[model samples]
Target: MSNDVKRPSGRHHGDLRRVLEEAALELVAEGGPKACTLAEVSRRAGVSVAAPYKHFADRDSLLAALVQKGYAEQRDRYVAAMKRKVEPAEQLAAFARAYVEFAAEQRPMFELTFAAGLDKTKYPELLNAGAELFEVLREPARNLRNTEAGSRDLVLAVAAAAHGLAVFVLEGVLLNVSQAKDLAASSARAIV
Candidate 1:
């Protein structure tokens, strides 16, 4: 059966780009980055295969846009998760949990966001958007009573641990670490 969910069939000429991007997102969500093709996105958006060329050069260009969109969403979630707690350590824990949860929940998008061959020079916006997630962690690390380098090191350590757990969850290799929140909270407690 076709996994393509029914999308808005009627789009204004000006909204085609947005429609195409939404279609591409759905495609990626269902089957990861390689599944997102310009032709498939156009068809899902109820447009001609040629339509996407007006907005995107090729599959990579569209994927780049998707990466930016994914980062922006992750960054927003990180900000909101951090705001729920006043304590720095709590906020850090929240950030870590959110990161891992995002990976598990939006597995395909998360995979594409970190995919190799994503040339940052060509897509600077993606880099800037992704940086926001790190900034949230950095803010909470300031309360750890460390020098600049020490704080940086702490943030990296925490991120590395969280990412490792997230990867394990995504790969389904670890049977014990099933819950993203619990694993993330445990890792956070150990560090903070």
Candidate 2:
């Protein structure tokens, strides 16, 4: 055999891990969760088939990593989007809007992270990460609830409405972001 093997150079081990994760994410985006195999991700990342194993134990591990990463990213977006000098009500509205925008923009990741049927116990890190995003909402929700018992009901009610609206919008049932934003705002007002 000819000795012409080209090795990956110039990147650290962490970089390789990132590349593997990114490749897996892309595969999931293109072909759903079933298509994201370790061999496929290695080939897509231009590394040897064994390279992925060095970073991920198996396909399931890689998927778990992807789910965890998705949760972290979603949480970061919420934190960044809500860090402004706006009213808590406005922040809540923006939070709902951000959730829909994120789901629409990252459909594959969203599906993998939130879609039913995954075993959360097997991936507690992802579960906690995902819970943290909702936990961030709890503070604002509690504040709104404090306005009145009715206000509390309103807060939960609006959140449920906003979540349903987001799912509808992401699935193409709703067509307009501005309209959704307006509707979410109105729903929030009715809650508080």
Candidate 3:
């Protein structure tokens, strides 16, 4: 019943870090957050149980690293997705679509990245990275800011909507990915 996937050989420091992340991601995907343990990840990663501590101070530290990595990846994708010069409305739509796509593709990491109960104050770097990801939406959101002074609220609303839409689509509420994309696009247009 192990969900461990095979990894390629010739790993370096970066590769080992990625291996740990991948193992944790697989565990989260199979079970929930509780499934991701230092020992379990070490076992799946083919490392000594004590090995993870060398990379991660503890379970929270590992989770923090995963969250930061996930946010960084998502941020990169969002930036790349916005490279085209489209209508503001279409740009926002594309951004929303991209958000859901990232969520769908990286569900386990996404969940860990956004999960509550983590002390953002204790993890300033992760908090800053996560904030920077959200900042990518500010361009499309700026169009809506003039009419509404609540820019922060608008950004949070759009993000929450995208996250909820992704959860719904992943949970089988939306039967089709295309349909989900359309819904997200339309929702972004309406909300932003």
| Order of candidate numbers by lDDT, starting with the best | 1, 3, 2
Instruction: State TM-scores per candidate.
Output: 0.84, 0.78, 0.85
lDDT of 3: 0.78
lDDT, candidate 3, 15-105, per-residue tens:
7777887888889899867788889998888877887877888888888888888888888887777677367666777877888888788
- Report the lDDT tens digits of candidate 1 across residue range 89-138: 78878878888888888877788888635788888887787677677678
Best by TM-score: 3
Candidate 2 lDDT by residue in tens digits, 1-192: 557864576233558998888888888888778777788888888878888878777787777887887888888887777776256776677677667777778877777776524677987887788668767766666665665554456556666777787778776888896777677766765665
Worst 10 residues of 3 by lDDT: 5-14
Q: What residue runs in model 3 are displaced by over 4 Å at the alpha carbon?
A: 1-14
Candidate that scores best on lDDT:
1
The candidates, ranked best first by TM-score, are 3, 1, 2
Candidate RMSDs in Å, in order, are 5.0, 3.3, 5.0
Backbone clashes in candidate 3 total 0
